[model samples]
Target: WQAKKLCPELVLVPPRHDRYAEISRQVNALYMQYTDLVEPASIDESYLDVTGSLPHFGLSAHALGDQVRRRVREEIGITISVGISFCKAFAKMGSDLKKPDATTEITRENYRDILWPLPVGALLYAGKRTCEQLRMQGIHTVGDLARTDRQALAALLGRGGDALWLAANGLEDAPVVPPDEQPAVKSVGNGRTFPRDLVTYDEVRRALITLSDEVATRLREAHMMCRAVQVSIKDPKLKVIVRQMQVGRPTWQRREISDTALKVMAANWREGAPIRALTVTAENLIPADQATEQISLFDAVPQKQREKQEKLERAVLQLRKKYGADSILLGPGDEEH
Candidate 1:
């Protein structure tokens, strides 16, 4: 409503899901021609590992990126931005630096010169809150973050901060997994941008509950249990921060997931901060059949109670699948925020 009010003549077009999926397939096919190590990041973005193919095609990494961009434009009538770098994270970062039929290359020798001066937020996965925390410590630029002690970063933002430090120093080594290989699922999560900013604890709690419920549902559907819960918060200004914590046990219960997400949010988020979006993710996943929960005599929640909740969640899932997603709603007292 705000956008339409600001621009009365603005046009709104509904998404064409089928058309987009078709185009995505064609683009992936084009990438396969260059290398089989094609990792589709999303319907519109992909990462191609052309190391082996570079020698085969007699082209440098940058040349291959340009060729792919040109082929995409000429064949599909769409322009793409390409980033060429030694590692997956840096390549992903480089791709975002340019747009619309451009290629940005970050070689090992030149990466520090090109990326070190940029803001810490420019690094992949460095959310808005993380940037603010880094700035608070007088670490302003990518170089500053890279130069900071890795142990300090880990203490500051957990493992994610450690990842940022690695990426800043160009030490990231994550590979672009091929589609046919079918890598194991590492995490299941959900997030949304609300229509309005959420200011109160109740509002944030409600949003977190919804997202956690969704994540739990997905985990259960896949026969998985997560030992950790991750939350990503995006403020009204479009800055984001991601944090996660161990749930103390591998579980697929919505109540547990929501509680852990709430804890994470409480630790990182300031009271009354206007949140534009919230995400809840289940991480450190293991197969439900394989997950062994150690029964603690000191456990606050009884094992029987936990089992009952799990049964209820499974029943709810069955109802949603048999009827419709909206056919049933969770009772108010199932869990507390």
Candidate 2:
């Protein structure tokens, strides 16, 4: 309502996440009919690596793209634009050149003429803010960005600018990830915005316990362990403060994650400060099977005890999986209010 007062033309539509996901799956299935190497970029976009299928289909890239567009229009009753190129970046760039039902091809011989004249902001990852910065530096076009020195761009916009310059020049060769493959897990995190502001240590501790339990569960599910824990505290005024600390041992245990998150929170946040939200993130992830703990000489818990605790946790996890998530509770205050 407040936004409409400022912008009278604003139109709002309720999000249909489930329906969009189903549509995406159906579209990806159509891509798989042509090639198994389909990478879904988002709900509305995807990249297809049809190098091997090209010979079998007896069609050029542009023809294959046309076939895909026709198939989608006829079967799905939705029109799709496509771009055909040797690389994912340029292919994506080509796709954006046209609208609802068009196919644009960017071959090695013609890409320079087709891509270089576009504004620098048209490049992937170069948003409005980045374009403004680049324009201030006299980089107004994609050609200008490509010709700029990589080191100079890095100095101006950090590594992202240098990477963008490389991309503009068609120097990037990142492979399109296949649909069935899982990319390496970087971090697992969970956060919540409280209904009421919390200003007590007990409230904060309870919140951290709940968050850590979720994070630890996700880590275990991914077969990964975290070597560091980070806590983000957002005050009632929307100011945010983050603190992180490396753990003594890499762990996926709920107790360890909770304790570490609490330690960082205590170190960085005022004891009774009003907090609107908090997030606990497990970082520096490694495969659980490959994780080796450095046993301290003065360690309190023995290896046998630690092993037993992990076994018990795994058992509880299985019970929850078989019965229901609410079938088991860790402690007295574990139930969500």
Candidate 3:
């Protein structure tokens, strides 16, 4: 309401994710023209390692960046900021230094002069809490953080403090992974904010089933199974609580995910408490083919029954693919009831 009052002329627009993905593909194609070593960080950002292509393209790093920027604007009809540096972290920092259509280069010699004067919060992963902690210790600027004793900083902030100290001193060595060389699946999750607050176990149960179903579907699509399930609940006041539990075995079955999530919720959530949002996440993933389930001596659900369930779910997946996504529904209860 305050934003509307302050900017009465402001117009809101809904996001078109499909269209954005299409545009991202087009932009990435342009990046590939210069180097095969393109790493897409997000839908709108990418890092192009043009070191090998420098001789082939007959352009320096800065010059290559300018060319890429120009081609993106000309072909994709969107302006992009470019950053050229010896390392990935500093290059990302340089990109944030300007906006729209611009290029910034951070070299080994000049990084100290350019980056040290900036606020510590300007560094990546330095959030409000970290900033407050740093300020309390008289570490106000990036320089202050860089100059702080690494042992003392670690004592103050744990492992994260050591990482920040390294990043602050330009020792961050994380590589930019190309699209093809990206790491394996870590976790898959789905969440929803309801139109009305859910105040009953039944309501929460239905929501969890819906979220878990989607998460299971995604895991199967990726040919992965999760050994753990995590749930996040947000109340009407927007305070959030998260809980996770290890599964009996790694499984991508919707029933298993939903059941585990409900158990976690029962253990952590207060009964009849109003919740505005809920999320279900499948964690500690392993590839379905590589997953070796160890049968417990007192296991209730036998191996054969679990295999049959997997087959049934795959058949359902095929039916959903043939028809529309909403053609079938699983689970025992309906939200409308």
Better of 2 and 3 by TM-score: 3
lDDT of each: 0.86, 0.87, 0.87
RMSD per model, one decimal: 7.4, 6.6, 5.3
lDDT of 3 by residue, 7-43 (tens): 9998877566547767999999988888888899888
The TM-scores, one per candidate, come to 0.64, 0.65, 0.75
Candidate closest to the true structure, highest TM-score: 3
Which pairs clash in the backbone of model 2?
Answer: none
Whole-model lDDT, candidate 1?
A: 0.86
Which residues of candidate 1, in runs, are more than 4 Å off? 197-337
Error of 2 at 253 (Å): 9.0
lDDT of 2 by residue, 1-337 (tens): 6678899999988565546667788899999999888889988999998999999999998899999999999998889999988888899999999997999998889988999999998899998768989999999999999999999999999989888978888888988888469579899999999878999888899999989988988899899999999999998888898889998788998878998998998888777789999999999999999998677777647766778878877887787666556566556464322
Worst 10 residues of 3 by lDDT: 328-337
